[model samples]
Target: MIDSHIHADTRPFEDFEAMAVSGIREAVTCAHDPLEMLSSDVVMAHFRRILKVDPHRAALNGLKLHTALGVHPRAIPHDYMKVLEELPELLSDPSVVAVGEIGLDSGSETEMNVFIEQLRIADETDRRVIVHTPRSGKEEITPLIADLLSQHIDERRAVIEHVNMDVIPLLIESDFMLGLTVQPEKLTPQEAVQILKEYGTDRFVLNSDMSSSPSDPLSVPRTVHRMRISGFGEGDIMRVSEKNIRKFLKIKN
Candidate 1:
């Protein structure tokens, strides 16, 4: 199973061999900012480790792990565009699966500009687009994103992460896949029902937005149970959880 958004290697370069042993197949790890990771503040304020996770851990394993270097919305700084200009080397990495955690948020103009730059990179590379929309105050930016996405046509596979506000329709109507997270509370059974009825059974998926916090990584399974409680059929759950997710990401890859 894939934790579509994770900080598995935040500081210690903590490999997922333990998570793999625990039964998860793989995860997509992302961090906030390069400066934050390399900053004195992480250790000074949060007492978090500031070590950079080596990408060689991905090479250490074959089927059990892969890494996606997320140029996250929160991470893009003043010189980030220049850094991004030099990212072709990183983008072409064998382990890099997608180009994201890189969309709009409740950030400053600087962050938004960086988001657009990353969007441009994804468009150029024609890879899977992972979106990270904030909980509120992001609707006004959709038109801008749509304009960028419109150029990619049928090849740009879109996946929006940690979606809590109602943007499923936009994703469904457009060419992207909407991934819902089941955390902070477990009673969003309504989300599954809403997606199935409103967006049909093809483009919706569930994800574990795990981080340093203790979370059930089997978030997709919990979502399936909730869907079952909400009157969805077993076939519907199977299709959304197992079949559709792989289908969408495979198309993206």
Candidate 2:
């Protein structure tokens, strides 16, 4: 199985081995600035680590790690323009699968501007995007994100992530894929499976979104287990755990 979204850099090294054992053969680690003090240089280094260093770390534990690079809204720096300027070249790296961990957080103008700019870059470069929706104001922010996505990129090219019940109906009809992040703060494994039962598995994918926060690195696999016990068929299980994300990201392997 594949963990469709995670910040592997923020996770403990041992977690990779555990994830591999739990059936996570591949994963996508999205860029996020965890520190309060952010700079273009800091952001670049983070991207470099994900693109260069982290893959080797994951491989050592028997996992294939792909990456998504972008300026996260919460982590937007003072010299964010510099980071944006260098994004195209960094994104060209073969390990990069998307432009992400990018989206609205505070609902401020700056965050919106940066999010739109990344959307444009993703469109121009024809890369998939992993969009973040905040836990606090998802009710208000998600629609705005949907509207912006309509203007900036194709719906099929993005996954509106960290989704919850409040915003599910808002994105259910759209062409965009919905990311069900199984985390402590997000849905539990049972809840994620219930969602799949209600909505069907046509455009839903599962992820851990594991990072510095309290997260379950094995959440994706755990959810797969939940699906099996919930009477979900193998095809349904495969769609959420692996197939949907592979198709969404155009991942050949």
Give the candidate number with the greatest lDDT. 2
Q: Which ten residues in a row have the lowest lDDT in candidate 2?
A: 33-42
Cα RMSD, model 1? 5.3
TM-score of 1: 0.72
The positional error of residue 215 in candidate 1, measured at the CA in angstroms, is: 4.2
47-146: candidate 1 lDDT, tens digit per residue = 1221124344533542133445445665654455556665556667665667666776656676667666666776678667677776556566654555
lDDT of 1: 0.56
TM-score of each: 0.72, 0.98
Off by over 4 Å in 1: 10-23, 31-63, 151-156, 185-190, 213-215, 228-235, 251-253
**Candidate 2: tens digits of C-alpha lDDT, residues 1-253:** 9999999888888999999999999999999877763678888888888888889999999999999999998889899999999999988888899999899987899999999999989998999999999989899999999999989999999999998888999899899999999999889999999899999998899999999888999999999999999999999999999999999998987
- Colliding residue pairs in candidate 1: none
Q: What is the C-alpha lDDT of each candidate?
A: 0.56, 0.92
**In model 1, how large is the Cα lDDT of residue 245?**
59
